[model samples]
Target: MGRLKVRLILAFLSLILLPIGVTGSLLQLQSSELEEKERSYRDSMNELESTIKRELTQTSVSDLELNALVNQYAAEINIKDAEGETVFTSYKDPEAAPHNEAIVDSSTLFHVQAEDGRILFVELSSQLPFTDTILRSILISVGSGLIALILLIIGWTWYISRTILSPLKEIYAATEEVKEGNLDYPIQYRRKDEIGKFIRGFNTMRTHLKQSQEKEEQFKEDRKQLIANISHDLRTPLSSIKGYVEGLQDGVAQTDEMQEKYFRVIRQKTDQLDHLIEDLFQFSKLDLRQLPLDQQFVDSRVFFQSLLDDAVEDGKSKNVCIDVPRQIPSVTLSLDPVRITQVMNNLTENAVRYGADSIVISTRIDHDESNFTISVKDNGEGMEKEELTKIFSRFYRAEKSRSRESGGTGLGLAIVKSIIEQHGGSLWADSELNYGSTITFTLPFLKKELV
Candidate 1:
């Protein structure tokens, strides 16, 4: 389809070219009509002159008879004798001659002999059919037509400006508003054309920019909250370590027994601080998308076996019993082993800390074999529906008091979610209060496509 510019050009060009062409044609028609009229007048004048000659030569008529004969045939007639005396005249008012010699004078003067050898002068006065009055009328008609064409062009140009240029002006105004940070302003034009599509695109861009600004603002607010939470969480362990160190230095733990206990407490607090700082580092890397993934296809059976074995060893002292299918399917998958290991370790440790005796890790292939679903379940004091929804949010804990006491940094599940997303997968949790909680994530399996 042609664009609006091309269409408008064609419209204006036709208006200009067609009118000029028609006017030229009309001018030619008028000239041809005038030429035909002049030719007919010349023919009539020639016939009159021939008749005057034949009658005076062939007929035995006197000058008066010849004058009467010529007057009877012609519209305007005059005759003179050999001595240049007027013998006959046709005009009632002789001074009021009808001839306009400048335009197309047909008046002629010729001599003829009478039957008795008398010389006579024959004068015929006539005019062509196309006179100054008729020429002026044709010129006036052409002028009127030209005026009408010019008015039409002007009116069409006005209409085109209203239809096309006006909308463009509005679009430019909208852009100016946008430039001044007025994204809320709207373009009101609504047509099913290129201009309309442009307006819609502008509206969409405005909406996206507004949303982006809102997200950036929200991110700033979230950052503030994160800093506050991290500071408070860090101060707890630091304060405990400081207090125990002071006790040691001030001889509050004078005996070997007290000193040992104080040292142990200080070490535990130090470990908590270390874990919290590490989590903060990891969260920052993931948030910035700076963490690299070393993805590769590996046998699922071997990968899950090693992962579960390590989890079991770590949770052995905590009475954390974990289970996995012994005959796990040897399906091949593309994944980042290090990241997935981090995910499972975090989930397993969370379960062990939350007083879960048993943890189950299982996997299944989708019916279409397009994806593999991995689920980790624990029979712990599960969360409510509302808590489950926010379980993956940074620093969101199901039980804040218990989390603080248990030295939970509240970033494990959040990190888990980030890793899963980085691997192009989705993660969610399902749970019922007092029953159990299960976290499931899906990883797609690719197959070669037909080219």
Candidate 2:
């Protein structure tokens, strides 16, 4: 910034000095030429005076004739003899003359036999007025130089302010716009200077920040929608539980079997509410504070085997089949065992509620050793493509009221999504209507990938 100002100042000074320097050089040349002219004219006058002397001595001209000849010959000087008298002058009538005094020339004293015996008088008059004219010319040269210098500097200052400062003003205004939360403006510049670099950097930052802001806003909107859907789902089930329990308590459900069924429905509602509360707490921790996962190295193969065993024990009385791929890796992976178990249960439960009588638990360690991917593909009535679009939204239930009837809080996929993202992995759902839905999640390995 300071450098640009310095350059501008330098340009201004140069503009001011350029004309003055040229004017000074030309004035010096003119003065030298004036001196040469004076010397040439002075030399010609001396030669002419010598010829006049020779003619007067050789031809023996009369005084009147000589005076008339001298008068005719004189350019601006008067010629006279001894006693300091005007013998010949351009003006004969002394009273009606242009001058306030008479001419005084005493060069003829050289011809007289004086005591000193030498010419004491000079022939030429003093050129004080002509010298004054030369001095005036010099003054004019210096004055013009100053005027031109000032005019040029002023003109340059104006041009620079308009062309340079005007654009800079725009840059400043755009900068203020960014400060006020608008990072959508374009920076216009072509100069290969530091300001151009600044504009480019600013534009880069604006683009990045704009993207981040958009993501944040989208996430907020999704969260809001999720909360609304969850509340709606919970309200319907809660209302059903409330109505049935009240009926039983009021003896409206007179049969023992009817009372028992109403109590079971209340219990299911309580479990659903508890699960939703827990999901909400965990989601908050993962999304807002980025809490560290309580992780440990556990053999993933054995872990899935244990999950399969628990599923068998729980579903032995029900019509269900749980499957774990035998080719699952035996590698020790790091993760929060409890949270991962919760995720597995959530995915399995989602399948159990919406899947067919058969559910598959699959795991594979691909050539990409950077992460472990697990998929729980269900054979139940699958969802449409539109459901896949919002499968990870919190509290978004595809089956509507049926989701609450199936003990679903609609946050299983949403929580899985958050945890995967927190672990620097990814989760996604692929499904075909009435075919099946595959809920897949990845857990990143601690080390970077190897070729």
Candidate 3:
């Protein structure tokens, strides 16, 4: 911007000064030429005066001889006798002759006495070098220069206003719109100049602001849905617990075996409620970015082996089989062990809950060696494409009924995604309806010595 301002100022100064300088130079040259011509005219008049005086001293010439000698040097000549009567006059019209001494003084005048004692008065007037025509031409030239300068100034002003001031006005208007909660307004300028760059920056800022506003609105809506889901989930387990307690209060469990079954049912529902509450708490922490990570550079083989072992044991209880490859990569990884364990647990449990009979855990490193990926594949009743897109959204469930039989708080995958992202990784899913699903996540690889 500073450079642009300096350039405009310089250009404007050039526009104003160029014509003025040229015109001044021309006028100076014209004045010099006029002075030279006036000097030459004065020298010619002096020479004519000397010649006429020398000739009159030589001989008493006739009027015709005198007329011929002085005709070339003078415009009007009048010869007067000693009595002051005009003898020889060159004036075709007598009124055109000089009547007073003041008029005679304006022209070159000389008096020489002929041998016969008559005075020859010679008045020499030359045409002026600086004429009305030359003056008119000078006026026209200066006027044209002034007009062109004004037009140049006007053109420059219009260009500056269109390129600079116009965009500034648009930016001001966009700011006003943003202030009034309208983030969609964008400036339309395409010049690749300083002003163009500024406008582009402003437009980018507006786009980010609009996106941020949209995310905030979405977050609010997700929070509302979370509350409703929690209410519905809690009520189911709570109602069962309340009903069973009432059954015991009413002495409905008459036999020892029946009473034992009632106690087991109450304990199971209580556990479900406890699990739901714990999931809600962990999800809240992850959502709020308050979950602390105890990061360490740990061996990938040992980590996955331990994770698979736990998942295998847990899956057995749920009547699902967990499998792993024979060889797990021994690469080093930077991660929070506890968070990653939770992520694996969520994926495996989600597979089991969705009725997968077999779940396979696999790991591979990318060709670049910068990151490694882990995929939890399951032979479950996979989700539709539309559901897959939103699987990680909080409180979203592929099961529209949100049945308690699924035994989840609808935050498992969402929590998994958050934890993975916090670990400087990403999580996504691929699935086909009635086929199987693969939940893949990547973690950045770390050098063993960079711990």
Q: Which candidate comes out best when scored by TM-score?
A: 3
User: Which 10 residues in a row give candidate 1 its minimum summed lDDT?
Assistant: 92-101
Candidate 1 lDDT (Cα, whole model)?
A: 0.78
Model 3 worst lDDT run, 10 consecutive residues? 97-106
TM-score on alpha carbons, each prediction: 0.64, 0.59, 0.76
* Predicted structure 3, TM vs. truth: 0.76
Model 1 CA deviation exceeding 4 Å by range: 1-5, 21-164, 184-215, 247-264, 325-327, 351-358, 367-369, 379-402, 408-410, 431-436, 446-451
Which lDDT tens digits does candidate 2 get at residues 1-451?
6656776877867876777786788688878877786677566556656655554455432332433433433433354455666544433333332343333332322232223332222243322124555666788788878777887778777867765776678788888988999988877877656666777787788888899998899778868865775677668768888898779878888888988888888887788777767767776675676645787877777777787789766655567777765666665677787778778878877877886667777877655556778888888889999889888976678886678666676667877777667667788889999888888888865443322
| Candidates, ranked, TM-score | 3, 1, 2
List candidate 2 stretches off by more than 4 Å: 1-167, 172-183, 188-227, 290-292, 311-318, 366-369, 381-389, 446-451
Clashing pairs in 1: none
Residue pairs with clashing backbones, model 3: none
Residue lDDT tens for model 1, 363-450: 8767475666888899999989988889998778888878877777778898999888887878999998899899998876654420
**Can you write out model 3's per-residue Cα lDDT over 146-192, one digit (the tens) per residue?**
87678777888888888788889989999999999999898999977
Better of 1 and 3 by TM-score: 3
Model 1: how far residue 442 lies from native, Å: 2.3
Clashes of 1: 0
